[model samples]
Target: MSPISILTFVASLLFADLVNADRVLGAYIFQRHGDRSAKAWPPTKLTSLGYSQEYRTGSFFHDRYISDNSSYQIDGISTDIVNLAQVTASAPQDDVIDNSGEGFLQGLYPPVGSIATETLRNGSTIQSPLNGYQLIPMSDVRSGSGSEDNTWLQSASSCSKAKFSSNNYFNSKSYHDLLSTTRGLYQSLEPLVNQTFSPSELSYKNAYTIWDLLHVALIHNSTASFPSSVTLTDTVMQELFVLGNEHEFNLAYNISDPIRAVAGMNLAGEVLTALNETITSGGKSKLNIQFGAYASFLSYFGLSGLSSANANFTGIPGYASSMAWELVTNDEGTGMPPHVGH
Candidate 1:
């Protein structure tokens, strides 16, 4: 394996070795939504490529975890029954996440042969409808709905305490220390950002939106050139992208205070709750929970754990990238708690 991939594998093993599970039993997946238009702009919708990307991700999961010959497959549960009672799917209420979940589930339990043949009381064989496509229940968890917490999926925006903690990081010596090398890059980009958004709307404290605009424009609209004369060369834009990503990282999880990871803590708690429910209920009530959020949150989640294992764990996750924390056990039902791995 490449160095980075090897590091990630070693990290997973370390996490899995803790508490010593007999084998993997269940899992929880937190994924960054697939390709979409810039959120800073309007009509932020998923692209056709986004749908295809997530579909492939789901298919990959099927081969690894749900296939009949896979070690992770639930005993006595056929792949055809995955959509019936063996799997439950979900995402955030945002349309981007919702669509991504839909595409992913379709791949996990594709339409070709989703239904099972059954004999009725009158001895008549009944074939399922919808062209053998089973409809899996997908619950979009709305923030602030009853007891649902916003920190779970919207941690970058919703965690009040984490926000407070992150603010302190900006004032820390480490931030200033890094700024010495980055200040020049920011200076060049500041004028462009100011021109794009009102002074009140954008600032050094939160210029991620500006960086995002530049990024999207470079990727999606570069052939036509930018509407404004705020020219940014490819090298400059790439540097700014890295800096902006770092800003987002520190905002989500600062090293000085563990409270900076409060958002991740909240989401991790929810993941564990879902996994434990799946295990405690003998997989009867377990959910195939799928969380969709931005790459910033995914980096933060990793910084809270994986960074300790791999210092180079700093790249912003790719579009539709996912992390799964599998719950493994053995014949004796002895296992460790779920840990972030594949």
Candidate 2:
């Protein structure tokens, strides 16, 4: 068996440990923030549904990779009272994503309801808050040249080469063809977004923004008042989603230059380096979870040749989506699993 294995979830795919003979070492997880308030509206926050989505994702992973009964459990990971040294998590300080991380951790290490109290050395006893909720520190990944946060989304990082390559797409004959052909489709959306968008903003250029506004309404405000007035038909909404997917994927990657998807390049580098550390340290560092947006997922898929794997890999990932890498080996006694694997 190969020393390295991957478990990925796109959209609503369920979590299941693959049946294999390889021994589990450790894993690295990259997760997208769960559902949140629409970005079209400012000050976006994680909603109840978003929180639940993240919590459920974390719980499923814990069951498969951390629970005692799971055959794939990491060799020496802490199931409770999290050993901060073995597990590490990081997320940008954005409110929605930051809050999403906490929701995931809640399920990863649930409250110790009965073991909440501890006697102090001074004959005083104190109980942890929220019934001994495990408090794990998720480091803040700030925006900068070398920081990991910037690679999670194109907008978070400023890469001149990437910007130039991306802009060239807008000038292509294909882009122009689509823009002219899609006018009618966009115009129909005026009634729904009339107040929020100008006539010019309804074009293909703003496909994602327009789609997101309506999508959130379809999920949360179907009965309530949304931007202008007209309710979107299911067919129209589906088209918008398709258009948005194409638009976003194009911006994140292209055959012209790898610079177009620098975010993916950076992520690949980080994943490789971290995995190497796990092997070198003999699996002392167990699990690493990082949370980010969908942009990185799109680019990573393209760069890693996963875009050809399935329909899901080629499109925008749904909320709470995740991809993981496991360091595995069939060898019982090992200094390091083979440097290369079958």
Candidate 3:
């Protein structure tokens, strides 16, 4: 897993760098959106809990990358009012992802209050709204804008080769076998979605969709009774989770066809490019963050050989899960002679 690097479970990576490098120059972060209403059902939104989760996750990173207490803090980065040029952020136009990005940034650059006040020529001091709230701008990578393709966050419809590979999974023998074996399992859960999805959608083909709806409802609508009287046992939920994981993982990566993980490949390139900026700018550009989904995580894990290093890496990432690439070196001053780390 050594071609390039970004950190998910960061302890190992950070520890390795601490042993090899003296100063952290910069970093590139790619994080999943916070919990939301299930994507399996549309009109999805970022829940309040989702917002909190993202904020906490961002604050955690702030402690790790920008706070004075952090030993690995990115050199030359701001801890108060943001130097916007030193950092860059982006997310898709999607509501869930975009809002999650805002929440995370709020944590990363918290209200500086009087610390950010500016004195006018008349000697009157003014503070930004919400107690010197940092107005950090994030680029909205609009869908179908062609930017997504380059950034490795593109929708399925945009990548013909990847799309073709994903569709091929549906026609495979393994798919057919699973559909047959899971017939009764899926049929039993029909009562839960019969009112919303038509009868045709109650089959194994919609395993992930059906499971997603139920899973999200359990988390967000726990006070309410389920639509059906059947016992929604934990065993059944786990089974459903496994099935959905299998389905989505297949869609994201297939070792035989590199095209399947195009998004992940592009993500590696994007991360490399971001880190390169820090090197070229002599550490002036210190941090870069992007909000995204787990499909890209799965794709990247498989493509970058992380799955081989740790089997758990193949699984879909959870809400707010982040991977980072730190640009670090032993050199002093502002000269950023970057060193790569796994």
Candidate 4:
């Protein structure tokens, strides 16, 4: 072959490589919060058990992405000896358990009984207190004649006197403080509150708060009834997708919202199916399937809703969790076991 012909062939090979690179499938996945104990009145943090669960979840991903030799290869070397890099972001808003500032333990337990009341008929002192702090006539309690010596009357009079005479407590200042705190809390939720978008934006920030709230409630609420005011504001819907690729690609795509979820799942499924089909048609070696998902999401499917008819509508054999399963046969037309790595 001439020099120019050889150079042209080398350039053609590089072009083919570029085209194949662009065709490779990528995936991203987001998961719900990790298992938590019942919310504490003061807002419970993750417990030791919860931390252990998280650690195991992280390890599972690491093994799947970093240690899988047949499935995940990094820099032309097996990832079996390296750990996958993981990053986490947290919710900015504080989880408030009890915002009603009565007392810490007051509402934790239910009230035993109801308070008794008095009825006034002819404006006479009815149901007067026998000793103290009993049901007393409003007139006697407010009267300045000092004939009423009950503890309730004494307490009320003391409170009235203190309000009038003291400079320590100002009602206006207290009201202002309450308003300021409320405004601050509202400001903290500005991201969710201030989302203004056209009909075309496909970003997660546009749909996350609403989707997350609905999804969480749907899975956790006992009633399992849809919220009355649910309106699908956007075209995006949440889905889970499986992908077989390097850990970096998965991290880069990082599914964060319903739109991304559905898109990633569809794209990954299509690409994987196509790749498997190509191997079968061309008589190539079957590629191993190495997949990773958001840790909490795996738990949800394997242990929670995805296993039930109430949660899943269309069920098929070999389909597990939100992932679609398929087998690729070799030239001998022999079925091969799926090599799932992580």
**Number of the top-ranking candidate, with lDDT as the measure:** 3
Writing each residue's lDDT as its tens digit, candidate 1 over 1-342 gives: 111211112112233453554455566676666777765665467778888888898787777667777766644445666645656676666677777777887777776542456789999887677666656777765331211122222343455766677778679786777666665566666565555566454444444566667766666675455436566777776666666656666666656666666546656677767776665666554336565564334345555676566544554566667767665543444333343231
**Scored by CA lDDT, what does every candidate get?**
0.59, 0.74, 0.75, 0.25
Candidate 3 on 58-134: residue-level lDDT in tens? 89989999999998888878887789999899876677788888999999989987887899999998887898888
In angstroms, the error of model 1 at 108 is: 1.2
Give the TM-score comparing model 4 with the true structure, all chains together.
Answer: 0.22
Off by over 4 Å in 1: 1-23, 69-71, 113-130, 142-158, 173-195, 198-204, 227-234, 285-287, 295-303, 330-342
Q: By TM-score, who's the top model here?
A: 3
Ranking by TM-score: 3, 2, 1, 4
User: Which prediction has more favorable lDDT, 2 or 3?
Assistant: 3
TM accuracy, model 3: 0.88
- Residue 67's lDDT within candidate 2 is 93
Q: Considering lDDT, where higher is better, how would the candidates rank from best to worst?
A: 3, 2, 1, 4
Candidate 3, poorest ten consecutive residues by summed lDDT: 143-152
Residue 61 lDDT in model 1? 71
Show where candidate 2 strays beyond 4 Å: 1-19, 142-153, 224-231, 333-342
Give the per-residue lDDT of model 4 (tens digit) for 1-342: 000100000011112343332221111222122333322111333334433444454344333333434232111222321111211111212221111101111111112222222456866443323221221111111111220111111121223432242222223464345334434333333343234323232222122223333333334454324333443222222321111111112211222222212323433454355444433433232222222122222222323234243322111111011222222222122222132121
Give the higher-TM-score candidate: 1 or 2: 2
lDDT, candidate 3, equals 0.75
User: How many collisions per candidate?
Assistant: 5, 0, 2, 1
